[model samples]
Target: MKPTIIPFLTTRKLNPENQETPIHFLPQTITLKEYFFIRNHFEYPTQTQEAYFLPIVGEVIRPIIFKLEDIMRMPSKHLMLPLECSGNNRAFFHPKVYGEQWEDGAISQGLWKGVPLKDLLALIGLKRTALEVVFEAYDYGKRMDLEGDFHFARSLPIQKALHPDTLIAYELNGKPIPFKHGYPLRLIVPQWYAMASIKWVKRIVVIDHLFKGPFQEIDYNYYPYKDSDKGKTPVAQINVSSIIQQPQSYSILDNGKHVVEGIAWTGTGVIIEVEVSTDGGESWHKAILGQEQSHLYSWTFWKYDWKVSSKGEYLIMSRARDSFGNIQPFKAKWNRKGYGYNAVYTVKVKVE
Candidate 1:
């Protein structure tokens, strides 16, 4: 196993390990490549420049193979998108759940440059019968709970697959993607959770029916309580959420005034407002919103100033609301898989 290069990120291991960026390092609009969160289901695959080729097959007019040079020759698109793990904030679940116990750091925004997946799909000419597009990655390994080994694969609806913003990314933050980040090529599904953006992409297959892979059908799904009427749904887009990045949680500060800052993001729409509560949930104050990228998929930075009149223990919390009227819930809906935990976040600190 490769050691984590980012010293500050928290690492969790199963068969393939994953790392999350620290909250304190999230103030910047564009996260550095080194600090980007890493979630791997299998060991990173090794690909040489000479051996890289992406095959597009299954329900298509003509099966086509795209080499790295071919993809680079296509018109490139650059987008600043925020990718969050569906299981972000899973650590806060009341009953401890299985899987990565991510806090608020399993997310990062980056400028990605790549060929639009639609452009590639156009090259192969998708048949009218194609209903779903399956993306296959090179990484393969065994699961602790499952019986045999399998490669990572996920499918997106025909509409999402053809979305102009969806990309087969080759560059991250203007540089060639690092080896740990899928190197030559990866999928970038703009408004969806990072799981939908398969890394180390080696094949794109158009199918006439929905995919039933383990990662799609069994895992990455939200299983609600038995008594609830809500049926099981696949985890996709991010929920409205906010986090406190500045004034590290539980830090001792001199009595005076301090500025609290953090980020707010949503996959449904643009984040319009963020509210911060200094004393738990008793009173709330609106935070000053910072300039955000024109892209609706990017995160909005926000800050609020708090005047500390005396020294005492305080609970700080933040909640975000999106343009679609979706707001962070006080208590996240529980699910067996611990996916999409986007409840209001709170941190306790002391003033000396």
Candidate 2:
């Protein structure tokens, strides 16, 4: 069966095509695999499942190679993780930035099944000198900005790599991962941006020092200003954000009461509350929050009752607050690369 991917702007050539899910289709507890957003940095590899093998090397006491079956034989874990592209809301940035023009659709939650990454680390026995773990994927291609061809690679500090929730996921939402979604295997890092979760993973290298790959040292880094003394910081966890899924932008609705709903999430911590404003930001009301299956990594659904009494246009907005006291800003903080745009989302709707 063909995947049910919602269409979005294609940021790159045919290989690294990008697509996002529509906000109206995101009210469910778990986003369907077909509707999940796809952001590829390279073409999907055609490696067969049986030919897939993961090599664990570098500063490990015993370097080991794991085939698909070998990993499947290990203890399996299931986690509900919501993965968001660091540039999810990049389109809203002022002055127009380079890269994908993603809106709120570049986020989705899924039940991932795989072996804990720590378990694999334990089996290999990390050397005392190991400081960071690097993940490499089969996808490789040349970019205009970079010289020569390079495979997709990223690294994590030893602490985050060893987190219990980290997994080598092979299944998404109870089905074998689709090729577009990763296929045989991928890394799922809970609470982090999707960039940290390398897809089509082929190798796990435990290094004694930081891994300075292009992705880690360049592309994903964030710079606060166009010209600043402070260097760019690596994009890691997601910021607090929410989206109004119902009564989508420019939708015409009957003049009556309607329940406005959407999903809220954060990588720093659990979302504490979500507030809704019908009259732009002039006034706000607390929205009813829903139960979260994964308190730390999954998105929380929220709803608000709107009693539209007049026939006119309304500017509906939604902002979320996380447990860490971080709330979605009225305007997104402008960054050089246009990463992490978590501004309060506003949609204009007509009531008649």
- The CA lDDT of each predicted structure is 0.87, 0.87
Candidate 2 backbone collisions, by pair: none
Per-residue C-alpha lDDT of model 1 across residues 29-65, encoded as one tens digit per residue: 7888778888998887777663379999999999988
Question: Model 2, range 189-276, lDDT digits (tens) per residue?
Answer: 9888999998888889999998999999888888887877277788998999999988788999999899999989998878999999
Off by over 4 Å in 2: 1-13, 49-51, 227-230, 292-295
TM, every model? 0.94, 0.93
Candidate 1, poorest ten consecutive residues by summed lDDT: 6-15
| Error of model 1, residue 91, in angstroms | 0.9
For TM-score, the strongest prediction is 1
Candidate 1: pairs in clash:
none
The window of 10 residues in a row where model 2 has the poorest summed lDDT is 6-15
Candidate 1 has a TM-score of 0.94
